[model samples]
Target: MSLRFAEEIILLALDDQSGKLRPLPDRALELAVAGGLLMELAFANRIDTDQKQLTILDRSPTGDTVLDSVLQTLPEGDTSTIRQAISRVAADAPDFKDKILKSLVEKGILNREEHRFFFVLKERRYPMVDDREEKEVISRIRDVVIDGAIPDPKDVVLICLMNACDLSSAVFSDDELEQHSDRINQVARMDFIGQALAKAIAEIQEAILETISYMGM
Candidate 1:
């Protein structure tokens, strides 16, 4: 089965033992999933990006429902500023965590469990059913980040997605991230699509934070 880029990212964020994203922030996970969809479009050659803008290259159906839906809805034009496109897509996206989590459960990669506290408060947990997929993801990240090996384009994109989501601590300790910070950044910069996606993630995060701050005030 070919995993979508978003699926790969969702798997990477999950804990191999528990299948929960314990260390990653909820907000970051949301943005990362949304950004992953855009990255997938870029990978499919449906979109291209420079530092300042994102251009829709071909609006043809990617044969993937989720991706094709997004592509079909994109503004019909040559290009839009990167920030504009990012914000528009993100704002229009459905709840990413819920969507991706459901898909993972359906794939049998994770098992969904429901719990009730005192027979009232309900909670859900997704535990790993098969860990082989996640192991592959970790191996790829390890080869690039820890071994200092050159990353392939896909690996570079994954690294950038992980970093944008602040998920390094989930895979590596603070000490390791600090030691290899420069190297990680260097590898992440190898792909222009990843760079553009990272920028989008940052901008969306900032916008969310600002909104929260304003609401609090």
Candidate 2:
């Protein structure tokens, strides 16, 4: 099962794809948490019609350039109905709560305890981590993508080599994949990233020395 909180944490950092390696968006992550809470509340039938309507607009738009572009491309709809829905939700906070509560209860993922409620899955619950910690992880991933400091060069070379030779072997195991990934992050920083990638490709089966083939190629 997916960890709802973990998904929320990575939303914002996914926005900038300019980097060779992209990071998740922080705001998107927060929006996901909020959305999960909303989902929890809705399943509990604590949401009102109005609250649900408002929530649609509040959703995180990160990693959604295509969606956003599509939305903008859509022709305008009638505004009065949308406005009326907003007004109705604003008028009844209790109804909103009821709707959310009912929805959550219906989903069987939330349970009421006295007045308060709790999510069923432990993974859904998370304490907020500070920006510093988040930034550190992001930075490390970026460094790996840009610098080519992957812990194991052999695995990276093998993948590229396989591609060059048009050979289909057993897939890289998860651990080997992660090592190649680490190198990808580091390689993102290299001026000769393209060349390095080429070298990786050239290192596949060859009559000449592998390293020399990569160099000459």
Lowest lDDT sum, 10 consecutive residues, model 2, at 19-28
Cα RMSD for candidates in order: 2.4, 21.6
Name the candidate that leads on lDDT.
Answer: 1
- lDDT value for model 1: 0.79
Tell me the tens digit of each residue's lDDT in model 2 across 1-217: 1222213223222222221112222222222222333332223333322311322332234343322322232224322232232223223423333343334333443333332238444222212223343344334433444454452332332223222222211223456456565454334323222223233223221323555667888
Name the runs in model 1 displaced over 4 angstroms.
16-18, 23-26, 92-96, 116-121
- What is candidate 1's lDDT per residue for 81-188, written digit by digit as tens? 776776666665545556777888888888888788888747677888887877788788888999978787888888898888888776778898999998889888
Query: Once all C-alphas are superposed, what RMSD does model 2 give against the true structure?
Result: 21.6
Clash count per candidate: 0, 57
Give per-residue lDDT, candidate 2, residue 65.
Answer: 35
The runs of at least 3 residues in candidate 2 whose Cα sits more than 4 Å from the true structure, single-residue gaps closed, are: 1-84, 115-217
Cα lDDT of all candidates, in order?
A: 0.79, 0.31
